[model samples]
Target: MNWLKSGFELSFRIRPVGIALAALYAITCWATWRLSVDQFFLPAGIRVAALLLCPPRLWPYLILGEYAYFAQMRYPMIEAYGLGWVILASACLMPAVALIIHLHRKAMEATTEGWLLSVAASAALVASALKLGLSHLLWPAPPSMPFYSNAALFVLGDYIAILTVAPLALLWMRRRSGYDWSVWRLPPTLAALCSLCVLGALIALVGAHDPMARALLQLLLVLPVIALTCMHGWRGAAVGVPLMNLMLSVTMPTTGLPSSFDQTTFFTQQIIAITSTALLALGSRITHHYHQQARPAMEVSQAIAFSRSAHLANERDLRERALGLRRIADDIEAALGETAHLLRANGHEGPATDLLRTFSSRSQQFRELTSRVYPTELEHAGLYVALQAGGLREAWDSSHRLVRPLLAGDPCQLSMGLQLAAYRLLAEAVLLLLEEEKGQILIRARCGRSGGQLGIVFTVALLDRHSTLTPATQGLAIERLSARANAYSGAVQCRTNRIRIMMRDTPLDSAWLAPPRDVSYSSETSARH
Candidate 1:
C-alpha cells in the first residue's frame, strides 16, 4: 500500500501538463455554469477578468465551458447554433487576438523609437476589431449593449477592450511571475495626480456631461499613463492601467456584469491603460539614456579642476624649498667670515689660520653638497648613477656578492620619479642586511635592453635559521621597491628570498640629455664675502 502511494505521488509530480489541464477544465465548468445557467458570474461576459484570473492556455477550456452551458440552458429552448459554430467563431477571433499580442511582443524587443507605441496601438486595434466581428456574427444583440446597433461602435468597444486590457495583463503576469510588487508603490505626487484624474473622469461619466468633455477626459487618461511610464517604467504603468480600469468600472453604469455591454467597456478601459503605459515607459527610457550620457561629462569636468589645483600646489611647494635652501647657504657663509677674522687678529698664524681656512672650506663644501644631494642630475644620469650615489652599493655587494659594477652601460634613462624611488629601495635593502647579526648578504643587479625597454633586477640574500618571515616584515622592502617599477609602467616581483624590479625605458630626444639648469644663486653670498 505504501509503495502504491509513493508511485502515485511520483506520477502526479511528473505530469505537470496533465495537472494544469485538469485544473483548467474544472474552472471552465464552474465558469460556464455561472454564465449560461445561473447568470451569476461568467468568463464569457468578463473575459478580461477570466484572462487576469486564469492562464492563456486555459482560454479554450473556458470557451468549451461556454458551449456546454449553452447546450444545457439555451440551445434547445431558443436556438440550435451548434457547438461547432461557437468553436469556429472563437477559433477565428481568438487566434487574431493572440497573434496581435505576439506581434506586439516582437515589436517591443526592437529597441527603437515609436516601436512600443506602434505595437500597443496596432495590437489593440486588431484585437478589438477581431472580437467585434466575431461577436456581431455569433452573439445576439440587446438594447442595453453599447453600440449594439452600430458595427463601428462594436469595433471601437472591442478595440478599447483589447488595448486597455492586454498590455496591463501582460505586465501583471510578468510581475506576478517574478514576485515583484514595487510598481504598486507610487510617490505622493504621482498618486495625487492619478487621484485628481480619476475624480475628473468620474464627474464626466456621472453628469451625462458634454460629449467633448467626456472625450477630453478619455484623452487626458493618456497623459497620466505617460506620466506613470516616465516615473515608474512599463511595469508601473501596467499596474496603474488595471487600477484605472477598475476605477472606470466603479463609476460607469454596471448591471452586475455578465452583460455584453458591461464586458465590452471593461475590456476597452483595460486595453487603453496598457497601451498608454507601454508608450510612456518607452519614452521614459529614452529620456533616461540622455541623462546618463550627460552625467559622465560633469564628473570629468570636476576631475579636471581637481587635478589643476594639485599641480599649482606642487609648484608652490617647489618654489618655497628653493628659497629655504638659499637662506641656509647664506647663514653658513657668515659664520665662516667671523672665524677667519678672529684667527688673523690673534697672531696664532699657522694653526688658527688653518682652522679658519678649514671653516671657510667647509662652507664651500656645504654649498656643493647641497647642489649634488638635491641635483636634477639624476633625471639625466638615470637610475644607474642615482643608485650608486644614493648608498645601494653596500647592499649590492652583500646580497649578490657583487664586488664590481653591478650595472654599467650607456645611461639607463628612466623617469625621474622612478629613478629616485629605485635608488631609495636599493639603499634601504642594504641597510636592512647590515643590521643582521650574521649579516652576510649577496646582492646582484642585471640590466637588459629588450623590446624598446630597459629591465633591471636586484636581489638580496640573508642567512637566518628560520627561513619563514612574518608578513609585516617579510618582502615589505621588496614591495616598496616594486612600486618604483610600476611608476615606469613596469612590474616588480619577488620569489622566495629574491626581489626583482624591472622597467622599460622610453626613447628620448637629445634635448632630454641636456636638461636646462633653473638654479638661482644666493645674492646674500656677496655680503658674507
Candidate 2:
C-alpha cells in the first residue's frame, strides 16, 4: 500500500507521468462508473469533480480520457442512430462541461454557503441544459418519455450527480494534513448507517411495483440528510447524500418503477438535490456560528502565534485571517439577509417586504469585532481612521466621558506592528475604563528619532481622577496593553487615575521621515498588481 501511494505521489509530480496517470485514472473511473449502475450518468459527476478538484493543467488529460472512452461508444451509436446523431452526442458531452465548472471554482471558493451551492447548482444546470437542449431537439432521447420529461430528468440527474461527487472531492482537499481519516465521527456514522437501514427496509416493504409507495420512499430520503446535516454540517451531506443515492440505486427495482413514466424519480431527485444543497448551506452556517462562539480566544492566539520575525506579518496571511473574520460577519449577516426568505417561508408577506431594508446593515455591530480580530482596514485606511470611525468610539460616547485632544501624532509613521499594538492598547484601555460608566481617557503619540532608535511612543491616560474602576480591572487592562506593547519592547505604566502604554519598533530609516498614508504598501501594492 505504501509503495503504491509513493508511486502515485511521485507520478503526480512529473509532468508527462502525471498526465498519463490522470488520463488512465479517468478512463478507469469512466468505465467503472458506466458499469456501476444505469440509473444515473455517473460520468457527469466524474467530469465535474475533475474540474472541481484538479488544476487547469491536469484538465486536458481527464477530458481526453473521457473523450476516448466515449469514442468507443460513438461508433456503435452511429450504427443505431446514424452518423449525425452520434456526432451530436459526442459534441454535447465534450470538455465544455469541464470548462463550465472550471469557471465556477471561484464562486465555489466564496465564503457564503449560498454562493457555494447556488453557483454549483447553476453550473450543473448550464451543463445539463447544454446537453439536454441539443439532444432533445435533434433526436428522441430514450425511456419513451416526453421531451419535457426527459429534460427535467436530464437537469435533475446532473444536479444529483454533481452534488454527490464534487462536494466530497472538495472535502477531501480541505481536510488538514494527515487528518483525512479523522472526519468520520461516530454520530454521523451511526446516523448514516441508520438511514441506510431504514431506506433498505422501505425498499423491501414497498416492493417498487407501487407508484405511491415509490414516491413515498423517495420523499422520505430527505430525513437522513436532515439528520446527518444536523450532526456534522456540510461534511454530513457529503457523506449522506452519496450514501442514500447508492442505497436507492442498488435497492430499488429500476426497471418496473413507473409513475408518470418515471417523472416521479425526477421529482424526487430534485427534492434530494434541493434538500442536500439547503442542508449543506445551513449546516455550514450553523457550524461556523458555533465555532465562532466557542473559539474566539483560540482564533486570537492563532493570530498571534502565526506572527513572524519580520517587521510586519505576511500580508496574505493577515488578509486571509482578516477575510476569515469578515466571513464570520458575512455568515452572521447572511442570517438577516435571508430573513425575508424565512418570513416568506412562514407566509408573512407584509413584514418580509419591510425587513429587507435593514437586513443589509443588521450586522454592523460585528464590524468592531471583525476589525479587532485583524485590522484589515489598516491596509487601506491608516490606524487613526480605523479607530475613530467605527464602534471603537462608543467606548467614549456611551459612558458620557470626553477625551480632550483625543488623538495625536502621525499614526502612519509607526511601523505596522507598533500601530496595531497601539490600537489594541488603546481599545483595551478604553474598554477597561468604560466599566466605571464614565471616565475621560486621552491618547497622545509621537513618532520619530528617539535617541539612536526609530520608533513611536503612545500614551493612554484616564483623565478622570474620581472614577470607580477597581485596581484589579485596571491591572488586567495594563497587562493586555503590555502584551500588545511587547513586540515593540515598549513600556506600560499605571498611576492612581491613569495608565500609559508606549511602543516603538523597527529602525528609524529614511522611509519614516515621510511615511506613506498606507502603512503596509509593499504587500498591498504587489497583491493588487
Candidate 3:
C-alpha cells in the first residue's frame, strides 16, 4: 500500500510486490466501477491517476489489476461476445489507454496550475476515446447505445470522475502533519460528511420532482462547497467536491440516472466539472494569499537579529573597554593632580594650574572616545537624560543650534534593546537637522502603555528659519527616520517638516524583543544615511 501510495512515482519495472499491486489496482477498478454512472466514468479517472501518481514499472501491475477486475466482474459480458471478441477488446482497451497517457506523461506532470486537473482531462479523453473505439471493434453496439450521445457521455463521465476523485487523491498524498484542526464540535471533515448524508436523505424523500424543486436542491448542494472552499481554501474543495459527488450520486435515482443519457443529466455533468475546477483554482489562490501574509513575521526576525545579538554584545564589549580606558586616564589625571600640587607647594603657581587643566581635559577625551563605541552615558542615564544632559545636547547648543526637548511617560518600561533603538532614532534625526545648521529641531518623545503593549512615540519637528532647508531636504530626512522606524515594526507618518514614529514592545514588563524586520528597509536602504 505504501509503495502504491499517493505521490510514489510509478516506473516500469519487475518488482516482487506484483501480486499486491495487482490486488490494489483490482480494488481501485472495482470501486470506480461502483461509483460511476452513465457519462460519469470514474474508472477512466482511476487509470489516468494511477499513471500520473505511479511509475512506469508499476504500470504493468495496474494492467494486471485491470485484467483481474474485468475477468472477475466483467467476464460474463465478455463470454456472451465469445473468446475472439473478448481477446480483441481486452488487449486493445486499457493497454492502449496506458500507452497514450505514458507518452504525454511529462506534460501532465508539469508544474503548471492545472496539475492533476490537466491529467484528469487528458487521461479521461484518451481513455474514453480508446474505450469508445474498442466498444465497436468486435460487434455492433446495442440499440440503446446510440453512438453520438454515448461518445459524449463516455468522455464527460470520465472527466467528471477525475475531477471528483483526483483532488482527494492528491490531498491525501501531500497532507501535512500538525495541521491545526478546530477542537470544538465535530471536525470539519466529519461534519461535512454528516451534512451530506442528511442532505442526500432529504432530497431523496422530498419528492421534488418538479424542475424548480430539483433546481433548489442542486443549489443547496453547491452552497456547502463554496462555504468549504472559503473556510479551508483548495484543501476544503478537495474534501467537499468528493462529498457533493457522493450526494449527487445517491440522489441520482430520483431523476432516473444510470439509465440513459438525456439533456438535463448531460448539462448537469458539465456544470459539475466546470464549477469544481473553478472552486479548486480559487481555493489555491486563497491558500497562497495566507502564506504570503505570514512571511512578514520571518522578515521581522531577520531584520533585528544582528542589532539585538551582535550589536548589543558589541555594546557590552565597548563598555568594558571604556571602563579600562577611563581607569588608565584617571591614573594619569591623579598623577598630574599630585604633581600639580607639589609644583604649587614649591612656589610654581602658573605651571601647577596648567597641569591641573591638562589632566581634566584628557579624562573627558577618554570618555568621548568610549562613547563613540557604545554611548556609555545612554546606558546609565536612559534616553531622555542622555538627550537632555549628554554631549549630544551640549555639542549642538554650543554650535548655536537649539534642540527643544519634550519627553513623557516612564522610560523604564522600555527594554534595553528598544531604548537603544530610540536613542539611535533620535540621534540620527538631530544629526540630519544639525546638517542644515540653521534650523531649530524640536525633539518630542513619549513612552506609555497602549492597551496591552508598552510603546514609544518619537517625533522631530524641523522649525526651519531658512530657504535652504527645502521640502525636498525634509523629505529625505523623513525617509531616513522611517527606515529605522520601520525596521522595528513601527509606524511612521510625516506632515510638513514633522515626522512622527510609533514603535511597540511586547505586552507586560519585558520589552517587545522580537527580532528586527529586514523587509521594512528593503525599499529605503538609500535613506539609511
Candidate 4:
C-alpha cells in the first residue's frame, strides 16, 4: 500500500514549477510523517512560501494540489467516504492558510526579521486549531490522543515547519528573480569550519542520555549559528538554521514513540525556534547599523561637490561681467577724447579745457567702480598691494586718523574669489567708518592658519572715546559687508564702536549663507582696546 502511494505521488508531477513545488510539498508531508522521530509535520513552511512567492491567481492550483496529496495520503487509513470528509477539511484548511497570508501580505513581504516568523506562527496556530475542531465535530470516534494534546502537536509541528523552512524557500525564490546575493556569502573555509564544529557538537549530544547534557549541547549549537549570522546576515541565519536541524535529525535516535508526549523533543524544538529568531533579529540589526553609518558620510561628500560646482558657476559669471565693463570703459574714453579734440579744433579753448578736466575726473571714478566689481590689481599684485594702492586710507580725511596699511596675505596662494572678498570687506569697513565720522579709527589686517585652512581677519576699531556707533546706526554698513563676506563663506561682526570681518582663505562655493543679523558684542572688542 505504501509503495503504491509513493508511486502515485511520483506520477503526479505537473509541468509548471508551482505544480511541481506543490507535489514536492505533498511528498515531504508523507515522508516526514512516516520517517520523522516523532509525529512532526513539515508542510506549513512550503505552503506559506508558495503562497508568498507565487501570484494570487496561481494559488488555487497550489491549494488543489495540496488537497489532492492530502487525500491520497489519508486513503489507506480511512474508508472511501471518510476520505471525502478528510479531503474536504484539507481543502478548507489550504484556502484558510492562503487567506491569512493574503491578509498579512505586507508583513510577509517586509525585509525585517520578526514579521515573517510572527505571521507564519499565527497562521499555523489558527490553522491547527481549525483542523482539530473540525476533526472532533466530524470524526465518528475520538482519536488516540486527547483533544488538547493532539492540537498541541499539530500547532508545534506546523509552526516548526514554517520557522525552519520558509526562509530557505524565500531565498530560493529571490535567487530565481535575480536578486543580489553577494552580501550573504561568507569565506568558504570559515563556513566549512563552523559547520564542522556544529556537526561535531550535535554528534556528541546524540550519545548523551542525560537531559541536561542534551540541553547543554543544544545551547552550544547557537554559537556557530550566531557566527554565521554575523558573517552573512539573515541569509546566514537561513542557511545555518536548516543545517542544524538536519544535523539534529540525523544524530538523534528515532526509537519507539513516547508513551506520553515527548517533552524533550518538544523542548529542543522550542529552543531551536528561539535560536533562529534571535539570529535573524541580530542579522537585521547589523544590516540596519551599517546603513545608518553610511548615510551621513554620503551627504557631506555630496554637499562638498555641490559647493565646488556653485563656486565655478559664480566665477564664470563674474568673468563675463568684467569683460563687458572693460569694453564700456574703452568706448567712453574714446568718445570723450574725440569730443575734446572736436571742441579744441572749433576754437572753444576754455570750454574744451573744462570738458577735458571733467572727463578725466569721471574716467577716474569709472576705473574705481570697475576695480570694485572685479579687482585687476588684487588679481595681479595680491590683496596687500591692492589695498595699499586702492585708495582706502585716502577715502578717510585728516579728520579721522589714517591707518597706514589695511591688508595682509600671500596673494599668489589665495584664490581670486578669496582675494576679492577680502578686498571688498576692508573697502566696505573703511567706507563705513568714514561715513559715520568715527574719529581715530585703527584698522588692522592679519592672515594665518586656522583649523587646517588659511584664514584672514580685519578689525576696525574707533579710537575716539566720544565715538558712539551702535548696531542700529551701523545696520546698512553691517548688511553690505556681511552679504559680501558671506558670498566668500566669511562673517562680519559689529560690536560697540568696532567691526571685525573674518573668513577662511578657501573660496566659497555654496550659495547658502546666513543673512546679516544684530551683532552681539564680545570680550574680544575690549581685549583689542
Each candidate's root-mean-square deviation in Å?
Answer: 26.8, 28.3, 13.9, 17.6
Model 3 over residues 1-529: C-alpha lDDT tens digits? 7766665665765676877988897898777665555655566667766765677777778888877876765465554445654555555556766776667657544333345665666666766565556555544443245667656766777777777777776775555634465631446656665766676677667624554454456557777787787877777787788777766665554223222333554566577778888888777777667667766976776665543555456556766887787788778777888898899999999999888787678666656655644566776877777777665665657756665678998777677766776777777767776775355777778998877777899887776623245576567666776655654557666666666778776431133233001111111110000
Candidate achieving the largest TM-score: 3
The lDDT for every candidate, in the order shown, is 0.47, 0.60, 0.64, 0.64
**Alpha-carbon shift of residue 308 in model 3 (angstroms):** 9.6
Selected candidate, larger lDDT, 1 vs 3: 3
Alpha-carbon shift of residue 180 in model 3 (angstroms)? 8.5
The C-alpha stretches of model 2 lying farther than 4 A from their native spots are 1-39, 112-116, 136-145, 177-184, 187-192, 201-217, 256-263, 288-295, 301-529
- In model 4, what lDDT does residue 160 have? 62
- Model 4, range 217-289, lDDT digits (tens) per residue? 7667777777777776666777777666655555554443221134565667677777777777787677567
Q: Give the TM-score of each candidate.
A: 0.38, 0.50, 0.69, 0.52
Clash number for model 3? 17
lDDT minimum window of 10 residues, candidate 3: 520-529
For model 3, the stretches where C-alpha displacement exceeds 4 angstroms are: 1-13, 16-19, 84-112, 140-144, 173-201, 204-215, 227-233, 254-267, 281-365, 376-382, 385-404, 410-418, 448-455, 462-469, 489-499, 502-529
Model 4 global lDDT (CA atoms, 0 to 1): 0.64
Predicted structure 3, TM vs. truth: 0.69
Off by over 4 Å in 4: 1-40, 108-111, 172-197, 200-215, 230-233, 255-263, 285-529
**Model 1 Cα lDDT, one tens digit per residue, 227-254:** 6656655544554554554445444433
lDDT computed for candidate 2? 0.60
